[model samples]
Target: MRRIMLLLILYSSKASFSYWSRQMNGIRVSGWLVSCSYSHFTTSCH
Candidate 1:
């Protein structure tokens, strides 16, 4: 019983970690894109 419970906990934690990492990656990509565009605009204006 304890072994099964441990396995379940491990599985759930791993699943949540993957999901969180994916979300963070998406946010980072969008942030990079926004910064790139902003720099391009500023350089073009000057």
Candidate 2:
């Protein structure tokens, strides 16, 4: 559980960095941003 949480945080941070960098991998960047927000909302809601 702890490992998973750590990985999620790492992945989300990397996603945010890529999104801001405006990488050409268009769809993926948007997906990451959306997923990050979704996770945040779910956790906050719970």
Candidate 3:
């Protein structure tokens, strides 16, 4: 019983960690793209 509970806990934690990491990666990529585009726009304007 205890082993099963431990396995469940580990599985849940791993799943949550993966989900959060994916979300963070997506945010980071979008932020990078926005920054790149903004810089390009400014340089072109000048």
For each candidate in turn, the TM-score is 0.61, 0.39, 0.60
Give residue 34's error in model 2 in angstroms: 31
Q: Tens digit of lDDT per residue, candidate 2, span 1-46?
A: 9999999999998989977666656767778787888988767522
Local distance difference test, each candidate: 0.89, 0.79, 0.89
- Candidate 1 — what's its lDDT? 0.89
Give the clash total for candidate 3: 0
**TM-score for candidate 2, residues paired by index:** 0.39
Cα lDDT of model 3 by residue, 1-46, tens digit: 9999999999999989989999999999999888888988777522
Better of 2 and 3 by lDDT: 3
Q: Show the colliding residue pairs in model 1.
A: none
Top model number, TM-score? 1
- Mind giving the per-residue lDDT tens digits that candidate 1 earns over 1-46? 9999999999999999989999999999999888888988777522
lDDT of 3: 0.89
Clashes of each: 0, 0, 0
Residue 43, model 1: lDDT of: 77
